[model samples]
Target: MSTGGKVQWINPHMMRAQNFTIRFVKPSRHMPGIVALREIRKYQKSTVTLIQKFPFQRLVKEIAQNLKEEFRFQSSAVDAL
Candidate 1:
């Protein structure tokens, strides 16, 4: 099930696959793939420059934008206005 905002709650019983209609239980705290990727973007530093390749710059910028959006960070000097 999805809370449909910044959060989601996976049904743990679904993992077992033993019961299709198991009684509904509290949602698990674990995050899904998108959330994990967003979190990585939010906190991790860029290692792309160290790659020493022409393709890496684009990758770095893309990653930076992802990080910025995840944390709602301002991206430009004009953001102050």
Candidate 2:
């Protein structure tokens, strides 16, 4: 979920499908498309845990390089603010 609010478990089973029921919850916000697709391919794995274990090395390097290059080119003291 988005972590912006809470979900209520009012009606557990909404309707039945081929072999499953369309259960329901609250907060009324739809999940992102990428999240849904990743879940489908995870083989019943927990996306939350996977995201928690994700490495930030690439992201950190990109950010550090950007800062270094910016200062090397045309940086001012105001950039630190």
Candidate 3:
């Protein structure tokens, strides 16, 4: 079920279940250029980057405002109940 453009609850009994599987591959350091590619991937993952097009502070403020409105609505709903 959904509320306020978000999923509030899910009925597991009514949903289809599937088996989860995971595969692991062993890395071979003896492979040519594999080590360098792995190092580049590691560096890319470790580095933190921010978008320059939008103001981060404004985004945070908007999120805070949305949360505040949601909280107020929930509080009023509980009071009614």
RMSD of each: 15.5, 14.8, 22.3
Q: Best candidate per TM-score, number?
A: 3
**Range of the 10 consecutive residues with the lowest summed lDDT in candidate 3:** 20-29
Model 3 misplacement above 4 A: 1-48, 69-81
How does model 2 score by TM-score?
0.20
Higher-TM-score candidate of 2 and 3 = 3
For 1-81, candidate 1 gives per-residue lDDT tens digits of: 554344444465784576555353454555568788976896677644335443555555567687685433233522222
Indicate the residue-level lDDT of 33 in model 2.
91
* Residue ranges of candidate 2 with Cα displaced over 4 Å: 1-55, 69-81
lDDT of 2 at 40: 83
- Candidate 3 per-residue lDDT, tens place, 1-81, comes to 224444344445444354333333333234698879998898788845434323654455477677785423243443333
Q: How many steric clashes between backbone atoms does each model show?
A: 0, 0, 0
Clashing pairs in 1: none
lDDT of 2: 0.50
Residue 35, model 3: lDDT of 78
C-alpha positional error of residue 70 in candidate 3 after TM-score superposition, expressed in Å: 13
